[model samples]
Target chain A: QQPVQSPQAVILREGEDAVINCSSSKALYSVHWYRQKHGEAPVFLMILLKGGEQKGHDKISASFNEKKQQSSLYLTASQLSYSGTYFCGTEESTSYGKLTFGQGTILTVHP
Target chain B: DAGITQSPRHKVTETGTPVTLRCHQTENHRYMYWYRQDPGHGLRLIHYSYGVKDTDKGEVSDGYSVSRSKTEDFLLTLESATSSQTSVYFCAISDSEGLYSNQPQHFGDGTRLSIL
Candidate 1:
């Protein structure tokens, strides 16, 4: 099943911070995050395996909580270039290669 | 940039017509995927292939079909185009074991389809 993302939309200042959360009902093998600017394909950010691992890229970080069947993405010291739609893709136990993505969180970073 | 190219970046077709979108990868990855994006809904997998001639349906597989006769090409066909099918389509590729790891997927720019 597809995961659900909270705060469908968020606005942040250039130096502000925000968090986007994703939750799934089924057991997951991994959680992958991607960001998409307008009129472009989703760009991969990071992936969290089922073991509750934390991965970071620059000012972005994410944590996967297997027990809660959820993952959260953290964006700190936001920049204008960070504005875009973020999506979380979940890998189910039964479908190893198949990924189900959440609706998405639109983050708009302002100056 | 990932050696993935989707042909006919923009397409416009009449409803009920047959439309085929092609995805080509130069990396020779064993796994290829087709996905569609719509407002209020994230990228939904249409279908994917593990290897040549091997394929499986995804969550929203209706009204769509795929073929992978070779290693570098994966084709998605809209049996009959509909207004609801108007959306951007993405093609992704990954290595055989990358599917089980944190390996990121490489995506093509995308194909914008409009059904009139």
Candidate 2:
């Protein structure tokens, strides 16, 4: 099944912070994050394993909670370039090579 | 960035006509996937191939068929195009070395398909 993402949309100003959450009903082996711009494909951000490690790229970071089967993406000092739709893909233990993604959270960062 | 390319970057077709979208990858990844993006639906997998000639249906596979006769190419076809099929199609590739490995997928620019 596909994961559920919170905050269908969000607007932020430059240098602000925002968080997007993704939760699943089943146990997840890993969580993958991607950002898609207008008329563009989704770009990989980072992947978090079941170990619950926190990963960051530039001002963006993410955390995976194995117990809760949830993941959150954190963006700090948001820039206008960060404006896009964020999606979280989940991989279950039984699903091999099949990643289910959430509906997505639209983020608009204004200058 | 993974050397994945999708043909017919933009297309507008009439209803009931057949359409095919091609995806080619130079990375030689073992896994290739076809997904459609819409307004409410972020990205739904239509079909996928694990290797040459090995394919499987995804969640929203109805009315869509896929073929992977070669390892470098994966094709998604719509037998009869409809307005509902108008959406941006994306092709993704991933190389998972081991069963337990966590390999992220790389996507192509995407093909904008408009069915009238």
Question: What is candidate 1's lDDT per residue for B1-116, written digit by digit as tens?
Answer: 68999998999999999999999999989899999998888899999998999999998899999999999999999999999999999999977385463567788999999999
Flag clash pairs in model 2: none
Cα lDDT of model 2 by residue, A50-102, tens digit: 77653336667888988899999999999999999999999887777788899
Residue-pair clash count for candidate 2: 0
User: Taking the tens digit of each residue's C-alpha lDDT, what string does model 2 give over B1-116?
Assistant: 69999998999999999999999999989999999998898899899888899998888999999999999999999999999999999999998655432777899999999999
The TM-score obtained for chain B by all candidates, in the order given, is 0.95, 0.96
Q: Write the per-residue lDDT of candidate 1 for residues A5-86, one digit (tens) a residue.
A: 9989999989999999999999888898999999888888988887666443766788888888899999988999999999
**In candidate 1, which residue ranges exceed 4 Å CA deviation?**
A52-58, B96-101
